[model samples]
Target: MTHYRIDALRQTLVLAAPSDGLPHCTFWGARLPDGADLAQVAASAALDLTGGMLDANPELTLCPQTAAAFPGQPGLVVRSPDGTPLRPVFTKAGTKRTDTLSLAYTDEDLGLTLTFRFAADAATGIITASTTLDSDTPVLCDWLAAPVLPGPQLADQMIDFAGRWCDEFQPVTTPWATGIRARDNRTGRTGHEHFPAIILPARGCTNTGGEAHALHYGWSGGHRMLAEELPDGRRQIQFGHATASDPLPGTRFETAPLYAAFSDTGLNGCAVSFQRHLRDRIVTWPQPDTPRPVHYNCWEAIYFDHSLAALTAIADRAAALGAERFVLDDGWFKGRNDDTTSLGDWTIDATKWPDGLTPLIDHIHGLGMTFGLWFEPEMVNADSDLARAHPDWILGPTTQPLGRGQYVLDMANADLRDHLFTQITTTLSTHDIEYIKWDHNRVLPYNDAAQTRGTYDLLKRLRDAHPEVEIESCSSGGGRIDFGIMAHTQRVWLSDSNDALSRLRIQHDAALFLPSCVTGSHVGPRTCHTTGRIHSISFRAWVAAQRHMGFEMDPRELTDAEAATLTKVTAWYKANRDWLRTADILRLDAADPAIIAEQQQAADGTRFVVFAGHAGTSTQIAPRPLRLTGLDPAASYTIDLANREDISSLSRGTPALKSGPLTLTGQSLMSQGIALPYDLPDSMWIIEGHRA
Candidate 1:
């Protein structure tokens, strides 16, 4: 038997290969001491023989094989060109170790080779693993999972995500069962309904305490996830591209990287790992030294009605309200009076602006703000010039049903990608545009891995040409958000619903995997256009301030008092954004279920800010204590209610926090907690903390 182990600062993964077969993970948890024996650890994980079992239990290798008699779903499903299922039994071929571990196994008779790669990052505490298959001849791959890992035995329930448009990041918890729990997203995009992530919390786990494990499949295209409990009681997790997403037979197939993490410090540990890895590692920023600008998008403000006078006036008001960037949303392109037409036409509308976008761009720059434009480069209206000229460039059948009056551009076609690249770059080169709001308003007709890869290629080519421009991935809001797409983009529109009440919960849950810097949360109109519910400017502003702050509402509609409140919140966000951008967002455990709260602690642990949002009325009469986490227990700190003036008149009794700042040890604040000022539903209280 041979033993191998990979260690990060907080966790360790040990694998064992017995009798020269593919290695299987034997131990994965908290870091073992440097002097610990890996061989003994592998031996300790061995199970005893039982009746009704095979003469010998087959090892659950990284890629469990059907030929090996593994009693579970095989990790790799493939067939010969003639459609004959191939069961390739592999043996150890080679190994390489450095910062990352690579192991190769070969099935000589089948002329196939399988390789597993693992990398442990000390800084982010994330373990990224992937699997690749190479064959001498072409083969049809139905499914190919990233390196499979053992599920923790101590976990009683698993947490995944399910959401929809306007409502994203809804956590769904399920108890461990005897059979498989599978989720497959065939939408051809990183679907809002099926986020590619899973969390396994132990029997007794919370946000700030106990053991937990998490895995994020970093693929923007559709994916499949399986958490299976075998008849023998062992569990395995497999994540891969959606089954048969690759239509054509090929000699080489590979799975996207699967990011795995172990956290002894509870769910927050896993959250922090994913957050840090995505922000610091996966995403590549154009201007790393510049602070994130306050964005003002003119979508809900002026949907398809484009007038130079109205937009210029709106830019002035947005600049006055502290917006540092102005994004001119849809309807800029020629003949695009509505979503039904002119999607693929990248030229500026001569009727709306006979002088072209230069006037608007110049006016925005004059107001001391940068300019951004919106584009749906992957979709084309059937009535569009590009589509009518090259019908073959459109993906799927001509009789296929249209989505949102548009057909998906054949991204897999190099000619189509080249055309888009030239058209988009022409505008970027001709103007002072610094950002692109790349929107995909509709899903593809079918799942195609090549389509996603082709999109990535185009994005890379664009980025290489225009290194100064930033991109935001917006798919009708939250549909195309994952580490895979994030690799090419800098920001994500969290959701389309700008309702503050809904945003509080969505942002709270999304922070489990996304950091504050890349999540774009915007303040909408007094009456939300999507939900038709009205909210006070104060509630809306604070919720937007929780992430990459922006405004999506029309400035012309704001009353003087409402504008004042927005300006004040915008100033606050700007003042503290430097630290908040890099802060670790810790979700507070509010004793009151009605309150959705989070603490943004500075990297140095010297200062922190807590946003306690009153989502609804409490079951009891008074507010309960909200406990904070991720603090040095022995340190002394001063806490002040930044928004004490927002307290409601409904509560007659005064809470200590409503009066003045209180000095206490971190332990006291974490254990006993702080009493917040009484506030009504849809209101939020801002509390600032500093080490004393």
Candidate 2:
């Protein structure tokens, strides 16, 4: 047998392949202790047992089987020449690299060959596994998986997400029972309900406690994250592009890669690993040297009002308020007065602009703010010119349910996909647009896998053609957020609801895996359009400024005081954004669930930016004191207020920040939590700390 070991971000993943009989590979998860003997540990580890180096009993990373062999949950199930289930038999295995292994199998009965490809990053502890099945004989494949690992039955706890549109990333925990726990998003897109992730906590787990092994699917289309615990105490976890492909004779079918990461420092540790992988390896956009702009999007402000004069007036106010990106959302296209028409038309509304987008684009550029536009490339209304021209472009049946008064464009069709590529690339070539708010409003009605590949291909082509254009993935808000989409886009619109209180929870949950720099956190209007809840400008700006700062309101409508507050917040984010973009996020576990504190620490351990916020939830006479996390133990630090607010003004009786620049050791601040003001429940605090 041969062993492959890869160490990544404090954790280690080991893959084993048998020398002679059945060249199946098994995955083992473990913590990388300092100066441990890798060979000694791999020698004692068993493929099916849990403990030692093999903390996890993951079946072949890509389990290809048939009904005759290892029966249930086979990685690949294809019909034999006799129209029966065919299983793959191991042929040989080879060591590709120290961090990679390749295993090949063949099904003589079906004349098919299946090969598994596995690779791991030694820095992020993220293992990516993919497979390809080739044949000269045509066969009907029931289902195919990228990679499915059998989890240890000892992992008694499981965590996943469930939510709707505005309420996204709501974590749900359940004890591992006998039956199967399946999360299927058949919406043909990464549905708003559940993100493609699963975490198995060791025995009993807390936010920062216990060991966590997490798996995230890299495909964005309809996906399945499943965990099935059998009667023999074996648990199988599978995730991939939730569909099968029928390979033609002499053709090859491949599966997308699935990512797996493990951490002993609990869920947050696993999150940190994933976040590092995304920012450092996966995300394609180049991080600008300056801070991400405080964008002013005119979706809520203008909606369908797209006259050049009206947009110019709004752009002036946005620039005055220090908005760096002015996005003219929807209704800028030909004959697009509402969502009912003009989806696939890329041309500007000549009536609205009189000439073209150049007038408004030039005006926005003159104001020292970049210009952005909205595009729903994969959607077409029945009333659109593109749909009218190409009637067969829509995916699904002859008649399908419509969303936002439109049907999904079938990118699976080569002709339709090429047309979309032409329209989008043409628009980019013609305009000096800096950003695109790419929106996907509806779900895929049927055969979503092809559509997903088409979407990815289209984006890849767009990126290659226009490398400077940045794209924001907005799937009706929080619908298409995963490592798969992150590989193609810049930022995600966190949620449609900009109500600060709602965002406090949503942003907290999203930041678990998504870094603050890639999350679109916007300060909406005082009266939130979705929730109808009003919030103070101080509270709203405080929440949004901490992330990829932006505004979703009309700056011209804001009061003078509110406008000034917006400007100040934008300036503050710009000054501290360098550290914010690169810091390791540490989410503190508070006794009160309502009190959320996130600390961003610089790599050198010299600086820290702590953002703390609380919803209007009070217990007894006061709210609980907040404790910070991830600080140097013995280092002395100076805590200074961002806005120069005195400690007394913040909290009535707390003495921690009464004097000028409260100085304390990092150990003291973490061990003994700081008391916060009970009166200002809606407000948030931005405390800066520097090693002194």
Candidate 3:
């Protein structure tokens, strides 16, 4: 066996090529100690490769469960032109780069050439696997994967998430049972069912300790993630294109890279690693230096009540509240009074604004705030003129249920996609639009992968054309968030349920794969439109500050005290956003599951911010000491509480907060956590750390 290894970010990926007559490679996931021998480590952990050649033990293969072998669920399955199974035989392989490895295989009978590639990043500990298939003659690929990982030992627990439209990223954990545990999302969009991620916690891994292996499919559209434990003691985790596509002969097809990472420091460690990797390596297009403006979206402020005078007034108030971007969300276009009509009509409503949107747009610009518009380009109402003119453009058997009185356009249709792009481009080309809140309110029931591919193409083309404009992927609030869309979008609206208390969990789970910079968190109205829960302005703003900060409420409704709170929070975020955008995220564990605290640390260890979430359900009056993470233990620090005076509790004999910032050693602070005062229920606090 020839062993190859890539060491990165305190992790190592070892690949072994079996010289025996078997057509299988082995992958070993090892947390290498210093001066470890790659070959020796791999050899000691190698699987027993003694089984029938046609149906061998899956644990021995780099990609377990091949179609010809174990037969439960193959990572790659292809058929010949004659409709017979086609399996490739290994030919040759080599290292393309220090971080990348390539292996070639061919199915001569079917005239198909297959090459698998693996790449790793040493600093972030992210490993990616992908495959490219080229065919000389026509062939059909039922399914193809980027790379499959050999099942790891001591993986007795599984973790995944599931939620609906308003509530997303609800974590679900189960004991690692035998047989295939497949979690798939076929809803044309990423959907509300499951996030495109899966995790297997090594036997005893907890929030702060244990080993964790996570797999994430990078595609934004439909995708699948599975954790299968075969009867033969092989536990494999694989993710691939969930959308079905039939490639023709002479065509080349490459699956999106499947990213996997390992961590021995627990789940939060994995999350912090992922956050840093995505922010630094993947999200490279949108300049990190570009200030993420504190936006005031007019969605909850005045839904479907768009008018030049009203919007201008809102813009004035927004500017006063320190809003840098004034977004006119929904109902600005022609016949767009409700969700029912004018979806495909991109023209500005002349009836609502006699002159056009220029007056409002210019007014917003005059306030020193950039203008953003709402658009649902891939949707159309039956009452829309575009839909009437092209009835067949609606994707369906014409029997699909209407969501929000709308149907998804046939984005897969080239002509329809071209027309929709033209309509959107015309608005962007004519207006001084700096941002677009691209929304998709429904799902495509029909399994058409081409629709997703086409949407990606359209977004790519638009991005290429207007590189200056930033787009937000908001599928009725986080329905279409993945690395694929993250590649094109600047940020994602985390959820439509902006209730601060609920947002705590939503944002917490989102950080599992996304960086705080790309997660759109906004302070909504006092009474959330979705949950009807009223929360304090300070709490809302505090929760939002930990993310790409923004506001979704009407500033005109704010009291003097509320305005002051908003201003204070906005300024704090602006002052610290540089580090917040690129910092490492640490989700602190507490005895109470309802209590949430997150810390963001500057990479240089110079400063950090901690946002503490209160569900107001704890029976203990003092709660507990809130310890911090990602700090330089050797350094001295000064801690300042943003809401110091407001820190009062109903319990008697509790001490008041200090008048000024307190100085202490990082070691002391981390080991013996500072006591936080609890006030009202559903409250929040911002604690800052500065190097002393």
Candidate 4:
């Protein structure tokens, strides 16, 4: 028997290989003592024999094999070229260890080799694992999971996400069951309906306390997740590409990296791990030193109706309101007056701007705001010039039904990618554009792993050519938001629904895997375009301020008072954005269920800001005290209600915080919590704190 251990600051994973078979994780949890005995630990984890069971239980290896008689779902499923199911029993062949670990296993008779790789980052407390399969001859890969890991036995329920167009990042919790709980996303995109992540919280776990484990499958195309508890009571988690995503026979197949984390400090620990890893490690910023700019998008403002005069005036107003970037949304391309036409035609619309986009770009630059343009390069309208000219470039059958009046382009085709690269580069070279809002308004008719790889290739090529330009991944809202796509883009449009009430919940839940810097939340019109619900400017502004601040509403529609409120919040965001950009967003546990709140703490723990949104009316009279987390308990701090003036008239008695700032020890503040000023539904209270 051989034992190996990988350690992060907060957790450790120990793998054991017995009888020269593929290694299986024997222990995964809090870090063990440096002098601990690995061999004894592996022996301690063994299950005793029972009646009706095999004399010796088969090891649940990294890639559990059918030939090994493992009871749970096999991690790798493949077949020969003629469709004969192949069961390859992998045996230890080689091992490599450094900062990262790699183990190789071979099945000589099957002419196949399997390898598992793991890299543990102590700073981020995340362990990234992946699996690869190599065959001497071509084989069809039905499913290939990343390195399988043991699920936490103490966890009673697991949380996954399910959402739709205007609503994203909604958590769905399920109790642990005897059989498998599987989630498969076959939409060809990292869909809003199926976010590729799972969280296992122990029985008493909360947002800020107790043990938890999480795994995010960092693949944007599509994925399958399985959390299975065998009859023998052992649990295993498996994540991989959507079953049969690779339809063609190939000699090599690999699964995308699966980011796994263990948190003894609760769900927030896992959240912070993913957040920091994505922002600090995975995403490559174009301008690393620059502060995130306040964005103003003109999709809900002007839609497809483009006029130079209207847009220029809007740009002037946006600049006045403190917008540092102006993004001209859809309808900019040739003959594109609506979503029904002109997709895939990247040329500027001569009729919409006879002078081209130069005038708008120049005017925006003149106002001290950078310019960004929108593009849907992956989709084509049937009436588009590209589609009409090269019908073969369409991905699916000609008779396939259209989605949102557009069809997916064959991204797997090098020629199509080359054409798109040239078209996009021509525009980038023609203008002084600094950003691109890359939008995918529709899903592909079928799933194809090659399509995602091809898109990544094109994005990489573009980034290499125009390294200074930044990109945002926007797929009709939150469709393609995963670590995979984020590798090539800087920001993500959290959702299309700009309703402040909805945004409060969405942003809070999304913080599990996304940090504030890369999450783009925008203020919309008084009446939301998607939900048709009206919200006050203060509520909208504060909610948007929770992440990468932006505005998506028309400035012309704002009343003077509304505009004043927006400008004030914009200024506040700008003033604190330097620290806010890198802050760890800690979700507060509000005693009142109606309140959705979060605390953004500075890296040094010297300053913090809390945004408490009154999502709805409280069940009982008066507001309940909300407790904050991730604080220095022994330090003294001063807390002030930044928006005390927004308090409603119904609050007759003066709350201590409503009247003036209070100084207290962090322990007292966290233990007893703070009483916030009374506010109505759809309103938000801003509280600022500083160490005294």
Return the top candidate by lDDT. Answer: 1
* CA RMSD, predictions in order: 0.8, 3.6, 2.6, 0.8
Error of 1 at 539 (Å): 0.5
Q: What is the TM-score of each candidate against the true structure?
A: 0.99, 0.93, 0.94, 0.99
Q: All models: lDDT? A: 0.93, 0.76, 0.77, 0.92
Q: Give residue 58's error in model 4 in angstroms.
A: 1.4
lDDT of 2 by residue, 423-497 (tens): 888888998998999999887776457788888988998888888888999999999998888888998998888
Evaluated against the true structure, the overall lDDT of model 4 is: 0.92
Give per-candidate clash totals.
0, 2, 3, 0
Global CA lDDT computed for model 1: 0.93
Q: What's the C-alpha lDDT at position 302 in model 1?
A: 92
In Å, residue 23's CA in model 2 sits off its true spot by: 5.8
